[model samples]
Target: MLSRLTQRLTRGSGELREAAAAAGELGPRAVSLVPALRAALGGPDGGTTTPDLDADTAVAEALWRIGQDPGPVVAALDSVFVRAAQNPWGRWAGVRAARAAALLGPAGRPLTPRLHPLLGDPEQVPAAALALVAVADPASLDRTALAEAVLDAARREADPMGALRALEALGAGALSPAHRRSLAALADGDARVVRSGVEDRIIRGDETFRNRARALL
Candidate 1:
C-alpha cells in the first residue's frame, strides 16, 4: 500500500493529492514514503519550492504525519506559507498549511511568525489563529485579541468553521465581556449570523455552528 501511494505521489496533481492524504493516514508506518512525498513537493532534491501550492501543502503534511523526520517537513510547510503569501490565488494553500501546523501541535512552534500576521487576513485568520493557539506559548499571545479576530471572522467570513474552531481553541475562559455578548447574540440566532437568501442547508449549518459556539460559552 505504501509503495503504491508512493508511486501515485509522483503522478499528476490529483493522484499526488490523494496519495499524500492516504499516506498521511498511514502515519509513522508510512515513513518509507517520505522521500517520495518530498520529491512530490518539487524535484528529486525536494529543495526547489513548487508552484503548485496545494500539492506542496499536501506533500508537506504527509511528510509531517509520517514522522520519520521533521526538519525537512518544517521547511516544506514554511515554503508553502511563504509561496502562498506571494500568490493571491494560493490562499487556500495558506489555510491548509495553517491547519497542518495545528495538527503538528507544539512541533509547529517554528511557524509562529508566519502564522501571526495571518490573523489580519480574513481568509486566513481563523485557520492561522487556530494554529497559533496550538503552537504558541500562552505568554507570547494575547488571547483576547485572538478571540476578537476570530469573532470578526465568524461574523463576516464566508466559512465560519475555521473561526469557530479557533474560538474553541481559545475556549470560553479567554473571551472578554464584549466577546461573550457578541457570541451570545450569534448563538441566539442573530439574522446576520445566519445570513439571508442562502439555501436552507446553509442556514441550518449556521445554526449548528451557533449552537456549537454557544456550547463553548
Candidate 2:
C-alpha cells in the first residue's frame, strides 16, 4: 500500500520537471503549474516513485517562476502551509514549508496571520520562523512584543533558528548606529545561512534596511 501510494504520488515527476522547465522558458505563465505542483508536493494517494531530488528541484523551479507573481505565490504558499500542517511527517512537508515561507517573505500580506501558532509547532517551527522573518513589516511589527517572543523562544528552545529569525525580524526595524553595528557584526556570527541573508539585505539596501539606515543617518 505504501509502495503504491509512493508510486502514485511520484508519477508526475517528469511532467513537473517539464512544466518547470517550460515555465522558466515561458516566464510568469509558469504560475499555471501552481495547482499541479502543489498537488504533487502534498497529495497522499499519489505514488512515491518520484525521488526527493525530483520533487525538490520541481519546487525550486516553481518558486523561481512564482517570484514573477506575488499574488499567485502567496496563494500557493497558503496551500502549501495548509498541506504541511495536515501531514507534518509527509516526505516533502518541511521542504514545502521552507519554500513557501521563503516565497512569502517579500509579499508582507495579512494572509499569514497563523504564523505564530505554526512557529510553536516543533515540526513546523523552522519554516514558520523563516516565513515570519521574511514577511514581517518592520514598520508594523510591535517591537516590544516581538522582542518578548524572541527572548521567550530563546529560553524555551534549543534550536537557534527560531531566535535568529525573530532577531532578523526585529532588526528590520530602524536601528541606532550602535545597534546597526551590533547586527553588522552578526554578519559573521555562528549562523551562516541567516547571516548571509541578513548581509544580502544589507548589501541590497532592502527597503526595510534603507528605512532604518535613513533614520540612523
Candidate 3:
C-alpha cells in the first residue's frame, strides 16, 4: 500500500493528494515515502510548483510527519501559502498550512516571521496565532495580544472554529476582563453575534459557536 501511494506521489494523478494524506497518517512508519512526497510537491516536471495546492499541502505535511525534515517541508508549506493567495478559497488552504506548521512544534520556529504577519489577516489570524504558540515558547509571546486578535477573528461571519481553537491554545488565563465580557455577551447571543441569516446550517453553527464560547467562561 505504501509503495502504491509512493508511486501515486511521483505522478500528477488526481489521487495524489489522497495518497499523501494516507501516507501521512502512517506517520514515521512511512519514512520511506518521503522522497516521493517531495517529488509530488515539485510537480511531475520536477522544478515546477504543483498546480494543485491541496495536493502540495498534503505532500508537505506528510513529509514533516514522516521524515521530520524541517527544510523541505517548510519550503513546501511556503509554496502553499504563496500559491493559495491567488484563489478566493485560498484562506482555507492557508489555515491548513498554518496548522501543519504547528505540527512541527518548536522545529517550526523558522516560520515565525511569516506567521507574525498573518496575525493581521482576519481569516488566518486564529490559525496563525495558534501556530505561533506551538512553535514558540508561550512565555515569549504576548498572549493578551494574541487573544485579542482571535477574539476579533471570532466575530467574523464565517464560523469561528479557528478562533475557538486559538483561544484554547492561548489558555483561559489569557483572557482579560474585557475579553471575558465580550465572550459573555457572545454566549448570551448578543445582537451583534446573533445575525438573522437565511441558512439554517449557518444559524445552527453559530448557536454551536455560542455554546462553545460559553464553555470558555
Candidate 4:
C-alpha cells in the first residue's frame, strides 16, 4: 500500500496530495515512505498558489504521521526546516515544519529551543505554541514558559479558529492544571461563545484539532 502511494507521490500533480494523505492514513506502516515523502517536501520554493505548495503541506504533514521518533521522518522535516531557515520563501513552510517537530513529541524536544523564537513571531505563534505544548515534559522545558506562550497566543489571536487549533493540538487528555486554568480563563462574552462552540464540537468528538478548526470555519 505504501509502495503504491509512494510511486504516486512522484507524479507531480494531484497524485502527490493523495499519496501524502495515504501515507498519513497508513501511519507507522508507512514509515518506509519517508524518503519519498521527504523528496516531496524538499521544495524549489514554489509560490503558495502553486500545486507544489499543496504537496508540501500534505508531505510535511505526512512525514510526521509516518513516525514521530528521531528517524527518517523527523530528519526529513529537520532538513526542510534547515533549508526553510535559509531561504526567504521558507517562512511560508515554517508552520508545517513546526507542526512536524511537535508531532515527534519527546524525540522532537531538542527542537524546543530552536522553536522558541517563533513563539513571539506574529505569523508563527500558533504553530510554535502547538509545538511547545507537545513537549512540556516539566523536566526539560520551562512549563511556565510553555503555558504562558500558549495563553499569550490564544488571547492575542483575532480568529477563534486559530486559537482553537492551537488549544486542541494540546489535546484533552494531556492538558495540565495550568493549561486548564488558562483555557478556563478565556471565559467572557464573545470569547466564551467561541469556547462553547469548541466544547460542543468536542462533545460530538471531532476527529483531530486541525479538523475541528476546518469544520468550525
> Which ten residues in a row are the worst by lDDT in model 3?
42-51
Runs of candidate 3 exceeding 4 Å displacement: 43-51, 85-89, 137-139, 190-198
lDDT of 3 at 21: 91
lDDT of 3 by residue, 1-217 (tens): 8878877886568898899999999999998888778767753223223348777878888988788889898887777776666566677777788889899999888777768867767889988998999997767899999988888877764337778888888898899999998778777854646454677866787788888888878
Candidate number achieving the greatest TM-score relative to the actual structure: 1
- Separate clash counts for every candidate: 0, 11, 0, 0
Report the Cα lDDT for candidate 3. 0.79
Question: Where does model 1 exceed 4 Å of error?
Answer: 43-51, 192-198
Alpha-carbon TM-score of each model against the true structure: 0.89, 0.47, 0.85, 0.60
Ranking by TM-score: 1, 3, 4, 2
Which ranges of candidate 2 are over 4 A from the true structure?
1-11, 14-61, 64-67, 88-99, 106-110, 136-140, 151-158, 172-217
Query: Alpha-carbon error at 13 in model 1, in Å?
Result: 4.0
lDDT of each: 0.77, 0.47, 0.79, 0.61
Predicted candidate 2 versus true structure: per-residue lDDT over 1-217, tens digit per residue = 2232223333344445555545445445445555445555533333233343334444544655555555544554455444445553542454444545555556646445756666554435545555666776646555545444444443333233444554555565534455445444433333222223457663553334333433433
Q: Give the TM-score of candidate 3.
A: 0.85
C-alpha lDDT (0 to 100) for residue 201 of candidate 3? 67
**Residue 196 lDDT (model 2):** 34
- Model 1 TM-score on a 0 to 1 scale: 0.89
| Residue range 94-152, candidate 1, lDDT tens digits | 88888988877788789899898787778788898899999888789888998888888
lDDT of 2 at 29: 49
Best by lDDT: 3
